[model samples]
Target chain A: MEFYQRDRTLQPAGYTPIYKTSVARSPRQAMLSLQGSLSETTGPVFGQNELGPLDNDLIRNYAKDGDPIGERIIVHGRVLDENNRPVPHTLVEFWQANAGGRYRHKKDTYLAPIDPNFGGCGRALTDENGYYFFRTIKPGPYPWRNYVNSWRPAHIHFSVFGSGFAQRLITQMYFEGDPLIKECPIVHVIPDEDAINRLIAPIDLNGSIPLDTIAYKFDIVLRGRRSTLFENRLEGN
Target chain B: MVQSLDYLKETASQTAGPYVHIGLIPKQAGFDIFENNFTNIMADENTRGERIIIEGRVIDGTGTPLRDALLEIWQANSDGRYNHELDRQKQGQIDERFRGWGRAGTDFDTAVYRFETIKPGVVSGRNGLDMAPHINFWIVARGINIGLNTRMYFADEQEANATDPVLNLIEQTERRKTLIANRDDSGPVPVYRFDIVLQGENETVFFDV
Candidate 1:
């Protein structure tokens, strides 16, 4: 198999100019000279066969006898590489807050009541076509201490694993029309508004199970690029 | 100079956030979804090589521990052969029981993550040179946007560490210490402490890949 060539342009600059604090910690010197070596090639290899058909639903676990209390929703999408090829058998893991804007985590001291049924965690492997589907409740916005009273937009955390460790991605997917998105510090960290917009999932009524759940469609384009003209090449000149 | 027609761009990255453990380790988050969690023991008693424990903390720029950090490690087996198909086919036989991988999340209270596994053997690098015995670490926490990649080399193996191709590439000689784990022989099982600093003076040398 050929080595996966990554396009550097589409990737977020380690020290985002807008998010100035990132400069302090993000590697400046190493990023310039380092390239993926043999170590990168020698990473984890997971097979779909090793995984079993078990719990893939985020709304409810087996111990919880009933459905999770929340606004029932379905999140479906495809995982593709930069060249628009389907990345098959890759693990897609997701976690989110319950519909009441509360997580089932210990450190989350938020006052929101924890839904007895909702665990807000799910895992699914992308099929041969790179498609992954999950049944999860629509997460609610929650307050954080980013400022005095900052509320994070309703979002689901996503972790995707490619063939090698270098291709692994950890990101968040937000709702399409969440008003709180603009106010969120985490979302604002990305300098590119267009790139931030890519994180939001659009409503897909067709994908929703009628009378049971609404649906949101989000497609992850991992390590891909768009065409940009160089400054040296001016068409007018 | 000529201009290239198409240049592919990489996708942007985001922080794994506070709730990463909830998804990756559901059982740890009070859910019994999986029979075994993602960060369970890497090798069993039958596995070959000297058993060792790796304990460390993921600290931020201010030296505060990141309680939410989740770490994953991948390494070659005792015989320097990976559990992967290519390596197994090339190297002839690999220890069937050895998984060559482990994962761990920092304890919410203590903010320390630990893994128990055998010392990895020297593996052949891309150029066929003997690469140092090191474990690849992938880390994600609340503040980290993209997961940071680093390697933990054995501090005792000075000779091997000296010749490591990756370690030699570190231009700043001082920063290399951040990658080496100090051996603690006091414990019943040999323990190696490899604290990874995300920022400030002793930040671990993270790879671009």
Candidate 2:
């Protein structure tokens, strides 16, 4: 896999122009939402929260508190570089549909009515070492326009926070072979060769374990050299 | 330089800061534009995701990621729709790409992060008008928590930005700083890299909250 090293000198085509504009309050307000103790060294802070609204689908199944299904994935891992160095105290969050493709939020309407047995969202906070995770269900692929023919693969959404306001990233993760990969407009936006091998969930069909207890592990590596970059497993064509 | 650094440090404690002056951001690169890259908030994944390679380093005023510093970005989906339950359209159809929201944290040396997402679509402005494509960004650094309600537009989007109501609101001089549409129709993925600095050189940016 070849990597496109950015030539800082080389410019992007028709990039958006910047115009001077006045804003409401000062930028100081930006950091207000965070909980930082000035008395403390400005190190990373990790946040924890209970599982969000269990969607109708997740509800159908009996939810036991300590069950592995309910047992927190404890998504604890460090965001490392190609060299495996830790990126300090960054902010992280994730959201996905219930196991059945429905969201706990009021936005979605694609899947069949409701399974009444799923949880749609979870959030994680990284400790001083830049790591965070959310216990969440596998998001399902749904249909939309912009692309003449296609639906996105079931996947999770991740947002990484950093340095300046523009230092942010929002992207999706797909299950290996979700069938919706081929024509996704976002996937279409990239040349097939340049697109990284996508990450996907392996099926636990044989079920060496009980039906209710199942797990899949996926690792995420951010923008880097393609050789070291994880391949994007295309799905849902 | 060392003496001045110390002096400025003392001053920052008493001063109003660049955000109050409103004059400092213009001198720096990666300034703010009301329309484009980081602006719209999405309700869900499909219509509001921001998929792009965000590469840069953490540095003190000299240039760096503040390696230990953290960054957060939130925006609307490709269809210019957010995943918020309240943002439902008149048709009762939840906005596509409104994958509502998402977040990622930085690693020890990992200053850069990227996402695979479709480009966002045009959106309705606060004034009930049009806006160019953009993503919203929230950056957290040392004592600097800059909220930039900015946007990143494509270079070839001249025709689009021209009619964009938000872009039209600004005066021409400031407009160039806000809009980042450089004419690079030939590059790969039509890259739009916007790096931010917390203080000094190119200071971190701020928008009207």
Candidate 3:
């Protein structure tokens, strides 16, 4: 996996304090795509499955262009406490999709494209209520050597929260029956089909909202009595 | 529309009497770490056994649904005092009268991560200024990390607002919208709705600090 960083000497100084968003003195804008009517608000929309993580340290970024595997699809979701309450100001982080349908963040790499527009990774902080969301396109499947002439299903890799090294999860969201599932080597790793269903998000087509502007809602729970079978199989990092 | 708050009148609108205590309860990390960090956290000495709730939702740019994020809040008491080491050191040097500083931790899994603490106090300003009474928020969701350094100004405080040093630092265009606190629609948690709009078209106010 290839990791890249940005330059700071090039940062122009002025009203934008340049350190923290709160202290930005000039040209302060909301980081999301806010589109809506009078009372309601609709936030940001990045490029096709294209957006980088919204870290407070926007000054720095990790590039994925030089990596061997490529589909840089940025996958995102939310995390809530058990009580069905919004914890409001929480942090969410995930890095997947390289462009050629591969991951550049290490751990998982199936060889995909390295999209320039799609940073292949993105990040967003949840609002007041524990509602965390992201703007990225669903990732496509890549062909692997699970079996001769076999390809993986269309899926987006995911991880939850920023407990640093102590907390990091690796799972993939597969679209409904994609035929390739029959032979994908990775999918075969999980012997049980019922278990895979848990991670597979039900298809909720964004018809009225087009793929370019589709909305997928996926929530994650860190630790609680209601544990998913997936966690039972693997431990998050 | 250049309007100021009605201070005394705004204070009149608030439910007066006993001010409450709040605490910070965060989930620890590591295996077997699943043990509730709250049990011992809520019982900490600083919190004084007072239960205060902070609640709100997490949403996206398109007004769509989002879930599974962690949030943290740290601020001063209703009297505008903090329990931090720095605040303690500056006590007499800064503003001997205001204690303004403390931190609380909580998570919102079902669409909202709320905190419970008595509303903070608007600390008297140093070098001739007034500090806004608001809590600082921090969030971490599936692979995202964000921070918002803002204060929840009471909707009613017209006078104190006008002279607020920090609030004044914000541009006139973003000031009004940012300096607001909404009432909680749910149960009587003394809710004040404060939403943070990330970068994009129309965004909420962001600080320069």
Candidate 4:
């Protein structure tokens, strides 16, 4: 029942004022660290039965007349622990703007027209090998109100649930060659270049469909469980 | 296990953004796509315990409620047992009907999130001491770069709350009140109001676990 401690240095600070929202939302007091209790060690599980047959296929899940207009691509990756162990059967959810850089959301006032055929959302479950793949259109970079000329890089939002509640993570995946990744204030939150590099998905020609779609590989790593032996459970395993 | 490579570093996080609803809860964003959608209802008629409703708003420094905020809660059953695999093996039995987890997005007009659940019993701490009844909460929203974690303790449980190991960890005794949820028994079902302040004089105590 032992779990590895989270590395605080790897995580972004709460008060990155350049992000604008941090000015009003960042806490003034320092956070308190605690050992993982039962609440933190356990999380809700989503089974295969809970998902639909087309849940992992964004290309056709919500398509009406024709496939969404854009560069068809496959986003494939593995869910692993910090210890490099495969985290199987975890739920991974994704959402993004269309290739035109316009979200279906009503609040998005971006001038880019919304693709009527694109829903821009999908879900997938990792296999025993912790592998998952989804078909989607390449999202377009878009503008935001962070600053006068603040524009987000082409990215996809991902929500992942590991075995433990403490392992729950929500992040954005950027393209490897996207230059905007270096300029976005949000991406600059992490001080380490290596940490930021892990978020970028590299092109995987080996995984690409010959005539149909290109493929990008983005593997996510969650907090790991330590190999410590618990005195009370030594006989159990 | 054959060790081939070093453990990979955990990936950096980004904001959920203004359009988080499109993926996390697509049904609320005008698309009824998910077959099994999660709601604030974690308990049913057969679930044993005192039924209660937890309601609150996430207020910012300017005293404005965040309309885009989303919250998820996880707690033990009324019997003080979690539905998790480890807890199930240790506790032996739990109310299977009690899902013990719920997700709720703030209302567009009201900016309040509510959860219908049964009051949880005392759970054991790491040292095997009795911990006060509380619910673990995880929050994220448009402006939040990383999800925040906090807990809600019942105000009525004074005796147990006084000795709570977790609550006592807060050096500032006055700031501990931020974690307490006030109870209103005037209604049919007891309602506990716990407003989480992200930044202000009454900012809630967030945890780094």
Best by TM-score: 4
> What ordering of candidates by lDDT runs from best to worst?
4, 1, 3, 2
lDDT per residue for candidate 2 within B16-108, as digits (tens), equals 111111111111212231111221222334343344443333344434454333334444455654444323333223344344233333334
lDDT of 1 by residue, A1-237 (tens): 223455444445555544443444355445423444434554565555654455467665532678777788889999987677787887888889988899988767899998888777878888899999988888999987656677889999998876556677888999988999998777877767778888999999999888888999988876532233453432110
Model 4 TM: 0.95
Q: What is the TM-score of chain B in candidate 2?
A: 0.56
Query: What value does DockQ give for candidate 2?
Result: 0.02
lDDT of 3 by residue, A35-147 (tens): 11100110111111222333311112332353223322223345543333343444444433433565433224444444444444434556655565554545566654423
Q: Which candidate should be chosen as best, given DockQ against the real structure?
A: 4
Here, model 1's chain A TM-score works out at 0.83
For model 3 chain A, the run of ten residues with the poorest summed lDDT: A35-44
Model 4 stretches with alpha carbons more than 4 Å out: A230-237, B1-5, B88-92
Ranking by TM-score: 4, 1, 2, 3
At residue B22, what lDDT does model 4 achieve? 88
Better candidate number, 3 or 4, judged by TM-score: 4
- For candidate 2, the per-residue lDDT at A224 reads 29
The CAPRI classification for model 4 reads as: medium
